[model samples]
Target: MTLSRRHLIAAAPLLGLTAPAVAQDAPLRFAVGPFQPTAGDTRRAYEPFFVHLAASLGRPYRLTVTADWAGIAVALATEQLDGAWMGPWGLGTR
Candidate 1:
């Protein structure tokens, strides 16, 4: 589920579409699958991009490093996450 910078760039349009519907003051909750060796490493690796995203969108964001696909899936299904950074192949689009 690790994302290259390219993947991040490609997701910008998707974010643009969804970010606006989020409440203006609520922190945007984002999740990531177990992309790195550890959660800390994953968070650190993606922090800069997420920071830039939040700042550029003028919104606060909370990043969560999920332990596995199921963890991220649950977060999204339950609305705990607004978006996620994942490999496109990891989950098929409906």
Candidate 2:
């Protein structure tokens, strides 16, 4: 099975809701897709964003940057990316 399906299946037990349904949880990893990291500057610049998000959500957050378009596609398709910025062709919806 694909990684996406596997992740969903593994998370099935935690998918149930309480009395009132609401998505108040935070994502563990924030994946930035298909972006070129300039001498590790991306990590330094965006690390604070992850830190702030984690602090606000009371959970740990990690920033993940995929190397190139293909990498991003693979990550997206495999569900390794929680949130990403994809270009027009990166989505592979053609």
Candidate 3:
């Protein structure tokens, strides 16, 4: 999703909740659904946020652009992704 610097700053604290357990050398995996019109658009919007986050946290952050919401969910459930940005409704009832 396209996140402004303000949004990222606000989310930093919440995202940090999971950061402690991750090793400093390990890359934090972050996934984003096809929220923007195109993958390139999404990446362009989010790339800077991840870069800033990585710098702020002093750890590398990997951004995975998923084609669909289901892929994001599966990745999270399987622990392939440490975090995700998607619509609340994207998460279906189990």
Candidate 4:
């Protein structure tokens, strides 16, 4: 069963079409800065917000908040997270 050149060419676009759908399945990483009084405080304030966002997006969202502002920057730079909610200073640096 050899694959003809025409068959290969026909399949190429199908493969490309599947990529976007696969990418859409990926989970979103939400980096929540230490923008609150504490980890507990931040979680309490934003946990519901994130749940709603994730539901609306039809994707999972993992909340990550560093102990300090520097940690949040490192996570963002490394691409460990996709986006973040930051305070005034956090937004300024990014």
Candidate 5:
């Protein structure tokens, strides 16, 4: 079945390490920092990667482009992001 953007958005809050009760079919929400020239550019660059990841895992994957490193961190910390591509500096101390 084709997953819609609404479905992915609905699943965002329950994605990633903190989501133990998430369904197996739930889409993985992958977050990326704003390191590229634009959000569209970042999405274009990583779309193939996410597609391959979904195919390999037999599950759907969604890409979320954050406005900045802080946004990425917030998404991760709040369990809204299942995975992330970010720099070490963005990973603040615990």
Candidate 6:
């Protein structure tokens, strides 16, 4: 879904850390921050969690590793990310 900038901003809060409303078959866009030194490392570390979400949600997903801690929030705000694994600080982005 192509979200307008206005809609993206408006829905940021409502979306939380989960995906925007989408078809079950639509690939959910999951994001990871710079918790690890490298994007590959981060993706590897979070692989199992993504597997779990895939199994539980019964849907496909794509992962994005942000270059910095704040990139996750930026991705969310721009509607580039659908789901994310974040801590307290990410919550403040709203």
Q: Which lDDT tens digits does candidate 5 get at residues 37-78?
A: 999998888678668655655577788877888777777678
Q: How much does each candidate deviate from the true structure in C-alpha RMSD? A: 5.7, 10.9, 5.6, 13.1, 8.5, 8.9
Worst 10 residues of 5 by lDDT: 14-23
Model 5 misplaced regions, further than 4 Å: 1-23, 87-94
Candidate 3: stretches off by over 4 Å:
1-20, 87-94
lDDT for each residue of candidate 6 in 13-84, tens digit (9 for 90 to 100): 554533434435777687877778788898899878767655455567788777876787788788777767
TM-score of each prediction? 0.71, 0.49, 0.69, 0.63, 0.66, 0.66
Each model's lDDT: 0.68, 0.49, 0.67, 0.60, 0.65, 0.65
Candidate 3, residue 76: Cα displacement in angstroms equals 0.4
Instruction: Write the residue-wise lDDT of candidate 3 on 1-94 in tens digits.
Output: 6565556546654654243534457887887778789998999887786687666656777898889988887877777776776656532211
Give the top-scoring candidate (TM-score). Answer: 1
lDDT score, candidate 6: 0.65
Q: Mind giving the per-residue lDDT tens digits that candidate 4 earns over 1-94? A: 6454455335433322133432476776776767578898988887786576556545676887677767767876776765566766433112
List clash counts for every candidate, in order: 0, 0, 0, 0, 0, 0
lDDT of 5: 0.65
List model 1 lDDT by residue over 2-85, tens digit each. Answer: 665456446655654253544367887777778789999998998787687666556788988888888777777776777777
- Worst-scoring 10-residue span by lDDT in model 4: 13-22
lDDT per residue as tens, model 2, 1-94:
4234345334423432121221345455555553445727756765675575445445555677666667656765675644444544332211
Worst 10 residues of 6 by lDDT: 15-24
| Model 2 stretches astray by more than 4 angstroms | 1-27, 33-39, 85-94
Residue 79's lDDT within candidate 4 is 64
